[model samples]
Target: MRLLEAFRGTAIQLPNRIAMAPMTRGRADDTTGVPHPMTAEYYAQRASAGLIVSEGVWIDQAGKSGPGIPGLVTAQHAEAWRQVTEAVHEKGGRIFAQLWHAGRVAHPGVTGRTPVAPSAVRQAGRIFSAEGWTDTVEPRALGEEEVGEVVRDFAGAARRAVEAGFDGVELHGANGYLIQQFLAGNTNRREDRYGGSVAARLAFPLEVVAAVVEQVGAAKVALRISPGNPENDIVEDDGKEVYSRLLAELRRYELAYLHVIDTPDTEALSYLRPLWPGTLVANLRSEEPTSREEGELLIGSGLADVVAFGRLFIANPDLPTRFALDAPLARADHDVYYGARLDGYTDFPAFDPDPAKFACSARS
Candidate 1:
């Protein structure tokens, strides 16, 4: 069968091709990782997407981002996530918990301790903390034993996600997090076995994948990666060869899908697609949205099986309906993209928010 056909047959079923990107809204209850009542209502509102990838959720204490960001290690976290998954599922939507470890991106004020990473180099950026946004400190480098502990943390988190009733788990390997920290050369200046060459650098992520797949079946596991993304100071020197080998390694597991974010041209996608050997979800930068006309072009031409939208999904809860009917889309408020609250998060009006506004396409 074709790649798109295979995606439709396996894993989560999508009512349409549109899938919501894993977006962070920071609405969890304090320290418990419980979704706020508003947060539950927010996701329930956006149930129109074929699949919803929940925000990046920390797997350990030291991996947390701020006061409201959730973690998946404890029973409290599981119970909280259960509410979220059940709410989305009730609305006929499938969800995946994006497993995350912030690594050096975390601040001591947030974790009440220094963050852990492959090396001691502090990320050259500020991180959100309870007090406020603060510069990241030099994180303590993980000893060889600590690496194994981190791996176990991820596996345990995967088990907790299953307990929480999520359809699957997507490893947070993108956006300069712990996994990306190891993948980058500048942040990882260690002489350890997990550092130095691209193959060695990928060891930590590969091990985490293996551990998670052992806990959850390979068909229920997906990984997200961003090549040449410097948003968080993630430099990818010779990223092509590095990602080529990484994709080859992923082929062994038969992952449910491989999601790549914001890569413009097809050069990297073309190079890595054959190596992946599974469903490909490409999230391109779309400013002027049109059924993801450009995105559909890529899909029809066979560059990707699905297209994930970030801001578009944020603004338009009923995006698939809007696309099919060519309805007007609500513009997203960038101010509320991060931090807490439901002003711009859940209160965004959809086509049928009120009975008067429900314009059936057949009405025309």
Candidate 2:
């Protein structure tokens, strides 16, 4: 029953230790980058999770990655997200918004501006656009002054998320985004204070975290990191040294929780777990799917305070309930995962104990 145990997080108390990992479903309004009505319905359906981390939400127009991604730049965008947070809260669930900036992963077709990164290095692949997948353009290196502006932008976005009623904000420092680009040496080749040594690489990311925590107290902020992850063409030589220095500085912030993605080498979680003083949320990256037994072992062993499940939560709206009852989980359909319709977004039904004898089926 470790998965069902209540967790005391920095910002809010979780009803259970099972969190819904953030996943982009591409169901937002394409033009304005606002979340669709169905997006609220989609999250409300899975409000049973201890904590619902929303899909990556753009912090500004220039930060947008592609079509169908949500933003928090304007009042309208905040209003749209308010509906989602309210829906989750009405069901007695807590939720956090994952504030994101794609950096070099963006394309002009998506953001109408040349992508910016710590360095001019471009990702090794194409990104989705209105015209379909297009080659990634070499990003312009951000000016020394511009870095501070981006930090302020994150603080502004954090304020907007709180205004929208989100319990907290999880700064997306993982997945080779803007933050990770600064952390990885292969992506950042600058000689400025933002790059070179471990302290220099950790400077910008730490500034961003400090800015966000200043806007909304440290208790209302969390960070997600993926050390040694080469996704989006990121390459890091020494993840241990980088993350050790990074977490050592981060320990002073006393944020809500540190959500770590298990690296393919499986060394990150084990190496950085002890460095983090607060709650730790681990997303196991394995060939096999996560199960109740695995979750129990992780929690029981004190390796992870909470466990996040991505695809499993997509198919099972009542994931915690299903785990509690040991019920069969529904398989997810990958085809409609990013479609702009409810077919695969909010249509996944909660588990039924006796479907043949259910009232709706009997009436049908």
* Winning candidate number (lDDT): 2
lDDT tens digits, residue span 208-317, model 1 = 99999999888878999887777567788878888888888887877778888755543567677777667787777435543456656767877778778778877888
> For model 1, which pairs clash?
none
TM-score of each: 0.91, 0.96
Candidate 2 ranges with C-alpha deviation above 4 Å:
355-364
What TM-score does candidate 2 get on C-alpha atoms?
Answer: 0.96
Q: For each candidate, what is the lDDT?
A: 0.79, 0.90
- Model 1 TM-score relative to the real fold: 0.91
Cα misplacement distance, residue 341 of candidate 2 (Å):
2.7
Q: For model 2, what is the alpha-carbon lDDT of residue 16?
A: 96
